[model samples]
Target: MKKVFTIIVLWVAVVGSMTAAEPVKLLTYNIKGHGMTDSRLDDIAAVINAQTPDIVALQEVDNRTFIGIKHDYLSELAQATGMHSSFFALVGSYYGVGLLSKTEPLSVQTQSFDPSDTSKDKEARGFLIAEFEDFYFISTHYSLNADDRDTATAWAINFARKSDKTVFIAGDFNAQPTYRAMVTFKNNGFSILNNTSAYTFPADGPTSCIDMIISYCSELGQEYDVAETGVVTSVNGLTLSDVSDHLPVYVVIDPIEESGVNNATETREMRLVRTSGGFSLSSLQAESMVNLYAMDGTLVDSHWVDNGEEVCFPASCRNGLYLVQVKNGYQNSTFKYILNH
Candidate 1:
């Protein structure tokens, strides 16, 4: 009887271990030219570091060459946070979008709407699409032109519908929810965050709610939960500041798992260290499988590293932290490490 009871307990443990809850956290911000002189970058970094989000989407990222400071805003943040990042210039010197993730991306692509027509300024602006393990995410800044805005909206929907994976779309869309473009996108499967009327732009007045985030399922049968959503609000009674005439939006999502409850365990004492090739697995045990994923939550690689095994990452590995998942039988663990140049 004791042996049978032990067997039952072990079975339950295995089932629990196999059930892993990996929540993907996302943030969208329009950091005004990296907040050049206001010292807002420090505040922005503080907020991001505190959230420790898995992915971040940024708009108005500077790419101008003449800027004496770091011209690549996203790259600088990626370096500061040890996360992999990508950027797309929507308007060259004026508007751009960026994606930063702690996980390595499978592929990065950019698309610029029709630039031939000068009337379509926003359409001339481009968007960046990032592919992670089982999901695809995009960021953009829409054109202020109404026709271009509508066209851009349609273009985004068309792309989302054709994607083979789950999608997360975020950026400064420049259109209210009441706008036809916003409505049409919602009619499809996109669920927007902050529907409760959030004030996002101009920083001071009451005109918020344009900067937005929305998500859609990839396949016909899969399910998703909005989980949690909100504005970054203010830290120490100070708002996102006048950095870009916009505020930051954030959302956390839980993708449905097939078997048991999906919950994450608290990761304590987690630290990322630079490594040649890649990183080493220290204090990890044998008989455990490890999965390396990009910030968009895409699995880049998986294997079994022997207990206390140290393996060098591939040279082509980009600079960023890789989400490391360690699983033994039914129980699981997660950690992150950074790669630097």
Candidate 2:
């Protein structure tokens, strides 16, 4: 009896160490070209910082198109949010989909899928997968056609199967939960997070739940347990208020240390993504002063501005990283951001 009790205690200790309770946060957002102007990257970062997600999937990204003012929104995002960014160019066009991770991903991979059909106007659809410590994360925006979605679904499942690790996918499917594409995911062991009937598009008035977070863990050497999942609504009274056409979705996964990948690659930074109407800072009081400083503690710019105003950084500002300090009386807040040109 004494030997049996010792063995049971040993087993319990092993399992307890294998599965830590700290959950990993995940978020998905379709930022509508990540906002219209170059300066808006900071605003988009603000939206992401507010969520404090460990990983994020984004769709409808503009790399460097005719109308896109920024040369590489991905790098700017990396600067703005200080997250490792990856992009998958769809149809060889400037527009595409991609992902960002709080931790430097172990690996990044991308593949184009048959969208059933493609025309000059319709860009090809694709998926980007990032390898983290224990699980694999994939991001893809599905085609508008039923046949295309079916094709993408099969490809995604095969791709996930390539790795024995648990896999989670998040993006805008452009289809309802009852669609055949979703059914295929279900049949292949993928389950949608937050199956509640909450809509995600048409930011002013959402009517359908097109955005989804799907996960698959099974007998093929996969293991994961979800802590919680839900839709991310707007940040009240901030620059990101009503920022995009669709609302973001998020999830928290338990035992994040299972695979021995520590996501603490860097310190968390705050970014302010712009709203459709433009940036708005409701937290600052009237007569607040703003100062921009380099990481080396060199004062670069200083100015006095009113609250709820959009302060666009001049193009002449040297590129790299900067510390943005907002001061009102004795209260002050500082933020770090990358400024890759």
Candidate 3:
């Protein structure tokens, strides 16, 4: 009887590890590139690799511009990451949104919304819908205008509802959680996966979780789970947002059929040297004004320091995400780091 009980316990543990609750990683990045250099593409690809995501939703892309990579970004990223690819040129063949997937999607389509009632100056926006083996993976970018964001999301929600397949959507919403589109989405049975206060804009220092993910599994409540949602901060020691204005937002979705509970994960500590004296900046050869901003883009504090000097936050400073900007009269550099309380 004792041997049988031990065997049962071991079997359960092994099954749990292989459960669908281990979400396939998904990432959304706005890679700011109406015209990007090859070196820039490499930098962006490096950042995406650090996370090892299962799929990625990318925007602000330029595909094969004359002076650009001279190759479709979808193909470039596929080559860079060894993923399959697709694209929707919202403006033209050169500029639009794209997707990179580790597995071949069953079907793919891009839908452009009718903005007849929207502002004329508003840019044309679209969404990418790729039918994966398990779910409908979607992507969109909302308008900078609050009202337009509502209109765009309304269209996207309508598109998503057209099919009953489990839907996983991601993009740069431009509207925060408090906004109307977001409110409507929440009310209409959509769940923001990484819907935390973690901001992901102005990569120099994010203040809003604009880049986001939303998921809807018809049986999610009964047989599925969203394991984790977060912002991807850095690659190597260099900061993102320095390359593009927005950081990557990610989500992990797991399926749970048996009686199961959510698994908690530890927060990843960013690799930067720090102490009680506050964190020190990397070596620079210039005297600079080291300005710090809260995740919401609020200027928390600033200091004048010589090159390679260590700057400290106030004693009253609380813990969260903060961005560091080092400016000399001649040139400026930005760095983003975390402050643990």
The best candidate in terms of lDDT? 3
The worst-scoring run of ten residues by lDDT in candidate 1 lies at 265-274
Position 294, candidate 3: lDDT? 89
**Which is the better candidate, 1 or 3, if ranked by TM-score?**
3
Indicate the worst ten consecutive residues by lDDT in candidate 2.
Answer: 264-273
Q: In candidate 3, which residue pairs get closer than 3 Å at backbone N, Cα or C atoms, i.e. clash?
A: 20-255, 21-254, 206-295, 207-295, 207-296, 223-256
Q: What tens-digit string does per-residue lDDT give for candidate 3 at 190-218?
A: 76666346678888978877888876544
Instruction: Compute the lDDT of residue 29 as modeled in candidate 1.
Output: 84
Residue 157 displacement in candidate 2 (angstroms) = 1.7
Candidate 3, after superposition: displacement of residue 287 in Å?
A: 50
Candidate 3, residue 89: the lDDT equals 81
Report the candidate with higher TM-score, 1 versus 2. 2
Question: Which is the better candidate, 2 or 3, if ranked by lDDT?
Answer: 3
Once superposed on the true structure, which residue ranges of model 3 sit more than 4 Å away at CA?
1-22, 65-70, 117-121, 219-223, 258-341
Ranking of all predicted structures according to TM-score, beginning with the best and ending with the worst: 3, 2, 1
Runs of candidate 2 with Cα error greater than 4 angstroms are 1-21, 65-70, 118-121, 220-222, 239-242, 256-341
